[model samples]
Target: MSVWDSIVGQQAVVGQLQAIVSGDPKALAQSWLICGPPGSGRSNVARAFAAALESPDRGLSDEPTNITRQVLSGTHPDVTTLATNKVTIGIDDVRQLILTSEQMPSTAPWRIIIIEDVDRMLERTTNVLLKEIEEPSPHTIWLLCAPSAQDVLPTIRSRTRIVNLAVPSTKAVADYLMASVNPALPAERQFDRHVAVRAARLAEGHIGIAKLYASDTQVMSDRDELIVGLLGLRKASDAVLLADDLIDTAKSQAEADVNRQTAAAEADFRRINGLGEQDRIPPKLRGAYNAIAKKDEIKRRATRRSRDVLDRALNSAASIYRDIAVLQNNAEDAVGLINMENRTAIAELSARLSRQEVVDRLEAITVARKRLLGNGNPMLVFEALFCALIPGRL
Candidate 1:
């Protein structure tokens, strides 16, 4: 299929990129910024745009060429991508990308650089990148992805053409989920239409999240448990216990993710060094391996992952309260509810608590999220949130 096929509910964006790819090469800007909400496929759009630019027929053909395939897989020689899991992108990383940007394209018509989460870079690092963007090489093209233009420095945003992508409609996302084959699943397996529709609704227009909710039964169960637990809370002790449980779960998930990533990195390092799975590293190579397995970076990544897990839980919690508020205001049918499966529980909670109490709990969730992001103690933050969520605690 065509490279753009993978992108869902973005026909206008595809059309814009297609026009640019088909237009005069000399008139194209050297840098572009792609802005969208989380799971809205900002990174996917960047890669698709890069593929189109490098495609033999300029992405007009029905099927992707080999160049398009390579670009999509991120194995193309002319494409450089930086997609980090860390809390921030360091200055050194930007410097390295700058060096890569100076080189001429080895094979393709343009040397493309795609940086996902550009907002993660601090001002100093962004300044380091600004010079290159301000005066990029003639054949170099930069594609930056962020949640919004406001996330990046004005100097950086001003130098590039901005493309904004909106959240897809619920029906659109549900249809895509039903039609798309998840590579992680068995070839013979497909998403049930009912499940896809529910996932799309729960995800609130986030395609990545909708896929997760559809494919992973555990995620859906955990969300259900959290909402149920919140509704069942009747005392401060219960709130404290749930907070501890949440923290422990977040930590366990983060640790597992870090261990997996470390194992994969080690395996890749061994393969690159011509060593087998059971092979021992030579003395000289041991230091290099140690450097690759820096403890600080691993710790930071784990912390970030833990925080991410908790943040998602908080978002889910907020959605539950939002649904309750909708029911309280008698707008359930008009605006619809995110967690339709939990409508019974939400409706009961709506009846138990005052409208003002629901508002207080929602505000508490917003504060908890902010404090969590600000490096506040997660346990305390969660405890406060849970306590506020207790019915009539306000």
Candidate 2:
């Protein structure tokens, strides 16, 4: 129940950070870079470390405590967490982080700044804080998280201590999901041990995705539908249509997300400014408020949508190829299918397609992902991706 307890399958990392929290000089560092695959709890560890630094007893508790909760919720005065919902973390964002780094802690022993997705920063933006990261104040600490050290620039990478977290085993992920979160699910939504293990296997060691598949029937259905659509692929026209369909779906989901975020931001702004439900902003301040909402908040969400949608679609496409590869190699029993329930369709597809073709298709998916990240038009990128999935297509 201590801050470290929530981190799963990272005993080495936990032990190291715990030593630092306990004032072990040998374990302390001014800056740290924590790298892990998606859902490997990079941010969780960073925030937990922050909590440990701020807590009066240095997270010595054997029970869950409010200090960890406050840190996670972004209410702790001593901790500043920088997370971008945008496509990239810009210079302005890094400057803001730098500004906070200069400030001393209000009450805690250190002023801890945790930046999630440090890999998202532009090369120029990352360069701006080289000095600060290398030479922060004695009471300041920076905890940066990304998918890998390679994703970060060498300059920034060299300045920090590195902690790499491996993907946990399927059994480990399933056990945590079933034992911790699944039991608290409402009766109608609860998943049994069988379902939990299946979800964990399907998610391929991604804890967050495993939880989604276990708890949400609709997400599982969507995944099933996507897999079925992938297996049904035949020729050029179908691939094009499928690409259009996936892109359109992503756009719709992004629009819904944007609307939800906008509404929440407006509501928060009204509450802060003492405005009522029906109140209108005064003309003098209206322009400023509108600018903040449009340029800063909503704009960021739009960029995030582009990347998120593409990543999701790419992962879905990649899963099919991965299953195909397993089936083609006759390794079904040795390395079970990710789409386990679709074994029949997978076997049929394996019979129809060469293993090399499947590997080529996966390579195409990787190329398209890079193009999309490079700001290639998503429609064009997806069109190319789907067409490539059909071996004989343009």
Candidate 3:
């Protein structure tokens, strides 16, 4: 399939990008701001654009060429991807990006730079990028992806062409997940279409989450357990234990993910330094390796873990309030439940709590979410949220 085919429910975006790649100078821009909600495939579309820019000879071919494959896999030298795992993208990071942006394309028509979370940069950091982005080399192209144009600074927003991506429909997400199934797998190993639809509905049109729910049994089970436990919080003591349990679950998931990432980082460092089984690093380079191994990477990874775990847990928790709101307002016909399988439990909550109480709980969740996103302590945020969730009883 064409590279753009993988981006679902953005036919207009695909058409525009295809035109630009096919020598339509009218559609070309030195810098582009791609705006979309999380899991709306902003980065994927940006990468596709980069690949197309680098592979003009491929000409929208159904099969991916080597250039397209390399760009997608992040191995193409001409394409630079700056993705931050930290709380903020620092001025130094922006300086490095600016430095690289001035370099001419090594092997492609454009030296494409893709910044995945441009919204994470501080104002000062963004200011550092303003000049370079506004006056990039003729052969350099900048692609910035964020939740929305509003997330970025006005200076940066004004200098770039904006493209918005809409969340794909449930059918679109399900169809894409099923189509992505490996053809080499046997019938027994293949995912059922039924599972795809259920997962898509549960994920609320988030393609990444939908695929995880469809493919991973443990993820599905954990989500069910979390939702069930949330609805079962009746007593004050029960809320405490459940809140602790939620924190523990998030910690465990975070630790597991962090361990895997650390291992991968270590392996990559070893390969890059050409360290063998017995060879010792030179004294001069020892400090550098240690910094990479222990300091910078570990700190960044920890920050990432905290943010990811908190965000995941909060999202799941928020869904309970969302489902309750839907039931309380008799809007079930308009919006589907993310936890539809636990409808009985949700219905029980709706019967017990008034519409205003449900709305209040949602407000608590929203406040907690904002605090966590602003680097508040996860445990503190969860404690307040959990207590508020069971108001009178807690």
Going through the candidates in the order shown, the clash numbers are 0, 0, 0
Q: CA lDDT of 339 in candidate 1?
A: 82
TM-score attained by model 3? 0.86
Candidate 1: clashing residue pairs, number: 0
Model 3 lowest lDDT segment of ten: 181-190
TM-score (all chains, Cα) for each model: 0.85, 0.83, 0.86
- The ten-residue window of minimal lDDT in model 2 covers 385-394
> 1 or 3: which has the higher lDDT?
1
- Candidate 2 lDDT, tens digit per residue, 105-187? 88777889999999998889999978999998878999999999999999999999999998877888888888887888888
lDDT of 1: 0.88
Q: How far does residue 60 in candidate 1 sit from its true spot (Å)?
A: 3.4
Query: What is the C-alpha lDDT profile of model 1 across 1-394, one tens digit per residue?
Result: 7888878888899899989999999999999999999988999999999999998888778878999999999999999999887679989999999999999999999999999999999999999999889889999999999999999999999999999998887888888887774545675545688888888888888898788778866666776777778878999999999899889878977887788789889999999999999998999899888866699988888998888779879988989888988998889889899988778888888889887887888889989988987789999999998998888778
Assess each prediction's global lDDT (C-alpha) against the native: 0.88, 0.82, 0.82
RMSD of 2: 3.9
Q: Ten residues in a row with the worst lDDT in model 1? A: 181-190
Supply the global lDDT for candidate 2.
Answer: 0.82
**143 Cα displacement, candidate 2 (Å):** 0.5
